[model samples]
Target: MSLQYVQGASLFTHINEVPKQYAYLTQNISTDVIIIGGGVTGSILGYYFSRQNIDCVLLEKSRIAFGSTSITTTLLQYELDSSLRDLEQYTPLENSLKAYKLGLKALDEIDAFINEQGNNCDYEKKDTLLYTSKKEEIAEVEEEYNLRKTHGFSAEFLTASSNPFSFDLKAGLYAMDGGAQLDPYKYTHQLLDVSSQKGLQVFENTEVVKVNYLDHGVEVETTYGYKVKGKIIIVATGYNTQLFTKRNFGVKTTTFNIATKPVTSFGGWPGRVLIRDNSSTYHYFRTTADNRILAGGEDISFVPGIFNEDAALEKYELLEARIKTMFPLIKDIEAEYKYCGAFASTQDNLGFLGKDPKNDKLWYCLGYGANGILFAILGGMMLSKLYLGTFDENLKLFKLDRFDG
Candidate 1:
């Protein structure tokens, strides 16, 4: 039975009327690296490997970026889903800071790649506003602000009086130049397009059905009975790794989002910064290049089965109500598109990005947090180095065995 990963009408403004046709694997092939999944993570791995003259083959079960990548809100924030203070409970403060710094570096790397490729992906550097809706949470927000400032990050504390939004901010941290937004679907296709020219082979509708580990390497058999032999296999398939591993690496949830039609004015939105609250399941929002408000985050526990139309409509209604509440002045903000998809979150809010402890050649890049895209960027870089026999100290923070029983 096929699973529906995404549902409802999702707008594709960033993507043009490009051809959807791609080659299907029908013959056996060999490569230095094999990447499963054609989303942003796999595309990044393909880009880095192909640029370094490594023979990489990427196989996707469906069309490129047709999975979670298409429905992603694309709010790139250096802040983890777990706050820095909260993350300290599971790991060392120094390690948490290292992950935060790595997120910042990933933002820089993404900007550099866009500049180098000159792709029009609606990439924009924006500030992030990590605020609390309740007045009682002001102290916690202040703690986060002070910690970031002490670590040399450019953070400013804001109170209800100083906050620029229409609503009462109570307290917030203005993370300057620490976030970005982009079109993940376009970015993935563009990266694959360029990499294909540099000897990177990509095949859509090629689903890997079985794996045969060899003494020297590994062989992956596709659904079409085509074999792919590679020195290493990177599973960038997001939360769909049940076929390969039995471990529950992350907790799965279904999140909803809605995109509004382009508005005429900002209506006191304040620099159009990316905004997220301090709620257990926070609402995140940002403006598109065309001035549309894209907000999401009414997450519910994941239920395995077909899409529930009634549940989806309820989530969309809640999301729309949230938009109206947040920006009261904006009138007639009709939701042009609404979508819901599966999202995964880890216990420590850090991604799992390294080799499987039981298997030597099987690597994983499961980025399970709000900083997933940033973590994917870091994963591509680190995993490439690991494959080349280089050791990175940061890899220890995301090892699969970090939470061993």
Candidate 2:
């Protein structure tokens, strides 16, 4: 059985056409660093290291960004649904602030890269609206808002009538600045292209069979029967890491995304405001530059054998129904495309980033939950700085040691 999310859409179906770059390790090879899982994190890390003249090689089990990164809705916002006040309970105030700042900085860096490279990825600065249908649920926004203000994050409160939505909500928290959106697949492949030009080698269709941490370097065994060694190894495999480490550090959750036909009346927002309902499984949404509505949420309990075509079809129907209520104009709208994938999430809703305690040179960047794109950019930057031997204060808060359980 194969994962739908990893299977990928046809090259011609996506917004951009990225040439397939595939390589296999048929012979013994060595590099300064070996990156596992060529998602956004590995690709960007390789790009940054290549720029620093480091000999880096990235290995992916399949195509680049063919994992959760491709299925992501790709809303680039620093507005964390995890309450800042809640984060302070588990971590230091300074650490929480650093996490917040780092997410924003990553967004800024990615935007700069897209501009500098002159890549057209439909990246746009938009406001995210946090709204709900229930009047009682409005206070959650206030509670979340107080923390944003306390942390000096720019946010505003909006009543339903204050915004352009045809329907009314109790209240919404709007992050005015530092929030942006993009086509994640295009953005990720663009990084892959740039990385290749910079001497960063990416090997697709090269599934990693095992990892051996040595005193001097890490050795990775591939399905093709060869040992590729590197000074360090970074794992961006997301949920697939469970195959190696059976520890309960990662919880798999399911989220659904449905691309509705373009909603043209869309004056209520510049499409930046993302609404977070105060439900156990919160739903959020944002619009693409072309006016298509991307709404995703309502987490389904994870079960084995739940990602098959049958399951995906059922979830697609659920999302289609939910999107209709959110946007009545598209009553006849059907899902153009649907994706179901697991995002490793921690109890605190923050990512797990650092070298594993068991192996000093084996690092991981996982558990962004619904905010992978934002943290992927941030994780890439931090990993790059760590590779460059720079002390990044922001990376400390999300250290894997936080879960001593």
| Winning candidate number (TM-score) | 1
Please give the distance, in angstroms, between residue 66's alpha carbon in candidate 2 and its true position after superposition: 1.8
**What is the C-alpha local distance difference test score of each model?**
0.86, 0.70
What's model 2's overall lDDT?
A: 0.70
Q: Tens-digit lDDT track for model 2 on 1-405? A: 125433224221264565566677678899988878777767777777787778888888877766766777776667565666666666666665666777788777877897788766677776666666778867777877777778788888777667566545778777776577777667767787887888888888888988887889889899988888999888777777754576666577777666766655654334435555656677767777766777777666666654566666676687777666666654455556566666556656677777787877888877466566667666676777787788677666677887786
Question: 1-405, model 1: which lDDT tens digit per residue?
Answer: 123878877655333444345799999999989999888889898988888788999999987888888888899998888677888788888888888899999999989998888856789999999999897899999999999999998999999889889766899999999899988777888889888999999998999999888889889999989999999899999988976799888888888999998888888688899999988898899988878899899889888875788988998998888888888888868788898888888877899998999998899988888888888888989888888889889999899999987
Report residue 266 deviation for candidate 1 (angstroms).
1.2
TM-score of each: 0.97, 0.89
Report the Cα lDDT for candidate 1.
Answer: 0.86
Error of 2 at 358 (Å): 2.4
What's the number of clashes in each of the models? 0, 10
For model 2, the superposed segments whose C-alpha errors exceed 4 Å read 1-16, 86-89, 92-94, 262-273, 307-314, 329-332
